[model samples]
Target: MASTASESKRVVIVTGAAEGIGRGIALRLANDGYNLGLFDLPKAEPNLTAVANEIRTTCGVRVSTVYGDVSQEEDVKRLVDIVVQELGSLYAMIANAGICINRPLHETTAEQSDKLLDINVKGTFYSFKHASIQLIKQGKGGRLVAASSIAGKRGFAEHAMYCASKFAVRGIVQCAALDYGEHGITVNAYAPGACETSLLTGVDEYFSERKGQPKGSYMEVFSAGSALKRIAQPRDVANLVSFFVSDDAAFVTGQTWLVDGGSVFD
Candidate 1:
């Protein structure tokens, strides 16, 4: 339902559309006149649909959903297919589905390691692979954006496996950008620091427990490390992604942008 000023609406597929930075990116793209295919875990259908409806009513753009786990390659492949089928074109693919476990490296378990790699690293790989294939096939260069973290820029104490996975995301973006540049597709990432989300709550709790401090005490420590002396909002990250997903960024690729408000310089 893009306005008549444009004859066609560009489409974007956003994974992890249920909450956090994913929801912020989806909403931001909708407001920017993109028809959307909102992807998330099956359990997130209700929340995802609510988000989709809000976009449709408020932005007057077409919005659809695909519920599946991002860890499975087949699931992610089908996700892009559904997006193309439902939305009519795939203009941008934002692989924003990621998870982190906050625990010391020595205490990390194999199960936790596998889960982290599967969802954070492999999930991004699957998304980047399938979306790039579709874009190449379409013969129209497109944007592929993945979620990284400040931890991706450098290692974190209690977030060891999480850091490794995000580092993998950055590597994949760079490699994919190199491989796909000839076809006109660009690959990039958005790395955010602590934000006001459940993910931050998890971080705060982990540090709080290790420091023997109250629940929110450690979050203040995190905020104070940032040059801005404030935590970023999800929208802060989403705004940068909006640029990467736009024609304005067509010439920019193979870059991992820090949305961390000077928390980490790379």
Candidate 2:
């Protein structure tokens, strides 16, 4: 079948594409016939190239992987350079790299807070900055989809720093959307709820140690607060991101779509 204009062969960059939600988004975009440029740390889990190869073989789109820390400006610039050189042009950028460290506000050290802000907030800023500049240079506009969190919409206990970072992401996306609208660029964010990923592994360990329970035993406890009473999968969040990056979502910008299974209704 012939692909639509939005689904046509276009260059797309996905940060944190080594695993979890970022990996899912990369695969989905590939299935829609997007050439892929995946960025993540060199030590990222799940072997980014393997996932990229799988997409290439299965979806029949070119895939490239660049190892870099999104928090570093030089690294992000290198990533964009690779995408432009290898993929020809940039059409979409998904800023999905993030870290979560849940702890009481008092227990959260200054360094930990700084690292969280660096990766979650500053990293996203760098992604948007480089990708938007490249898209503007291309003179075709582009899509910018960022990963916020349900924590951004509403604060969670013992997650003060994480919540603050995600809230900052939403604010940034909104402002960028308004600023870039005249240029035909759209910026939006997804607020995903609890998901089963390595990011949560530390939280699980923390809870198990604190509550005297098995690591996975608290999955239900954490999910019960949501109206759906089920934790979301990474693909669930990825699917929403896929939609937002498509032409169908051109009319939708500066909006925060919550995919937490009704965890944050507002």
Candidate 3:
């Protein structure tokens, strides 16, 4: 498929597009008629390339893949620049690259907390900052989205580090929305619950070991806690992201909306 111009399809940069929810969002946005800038860590180069290939073959959208650590400011700036050079102007950015630490407060070291905050909090800030700068320069409105978790809304037993990072993401989202609203850019986040991703699997494994239960015990517990009695899929969260980057959400900003299968009520 030929590459579409920025005015025709709109271009979006989705960080951590190698797998899981980020992969789902990249595919969903491509299908939504947006050219995609797929970014992920170098360690995930294979999966990231596969995602780009799949999009080109299936969605036929102009998709470009770049590997970088979002925690680094220079890498993020370069990512924004490269995507624009390859796929035309940037219309939106999905800052979905994040990590989790499942340790009690007593065991959580300052080093672990620093790493988590650097990627989760600082990374989102860079994504928002660079994307909004380009959008403002273009003099056209755009979208900025981030990954928050149900952990951000309420505290969990052994998720002090994770919760602090996610809660900080909410603060960044609200403040960015206010700062960039005048430029016609919307900033929002999607807070998902126990989704069927590797991240959640890790959490479940941690809990299972701590409680001396079977492998899937924590997964089952989380599923049962939700009103739907099932864990969420990547596509479910992608659907919410689909709405946020679309014209329908132009009036909506500064929201950390929940998509947790009714697990955590605001």
Best by lDDT: 3
Residue 258 shift from truth in candidate 3, angstroms:
0.5
Question: Candidates sorted by TM-score, descending order?
Answer: 3, 1, 2
For candidate 2, report its TM-score. Answer: 0.95
Give the per-residue lDDT digits (tens) of candidate 2, residues 1-266.
11453355788899999988888888888877788899999986358978987997798888888998998999999999998899888988899999998889999999999999999999999999999999888888889989899889988888999999999999999999998888899999999888888877777787777889988765777689788988888888878987887778889999989998877788
Backbone Cα, N, C clashes tallied per candidate: 0, 0, 0
Q: Which lDDT tens digits does candidate 1 get at residues 1-266?
A: 22321356888899998999999998888888888889998888889989998998998989889989999999999999988998788878999998879888899999999999999999999998899889999997888999999889998788899999999999999999999999999899999998888888987887888899999986787689989998889999999998998777879999999988778878
lDDT for each candidate structure: 0.89, 0.87, 0.92
Candidate 3 lDDT for residue 218: 89
Residue 250 alpha-carbon offset, candidate 3, angstroms? 0.8
Cα-based TM-score, every candidate:
0.96, 0.95, 0.97
Per residue, candidate 3 scores C-alpha lDDT tens digits across 162-244 of 99999999999999999999989999999999988898889899999999999999889989999999999999999999999
Model 3 per-residue lDDT at 191: 98
Model 1 per-residue lDDT at 92: 84
Cα-lDDT of candidate 2: 0.87
Itemize residue pairs with steric clashes in candidate 3. none
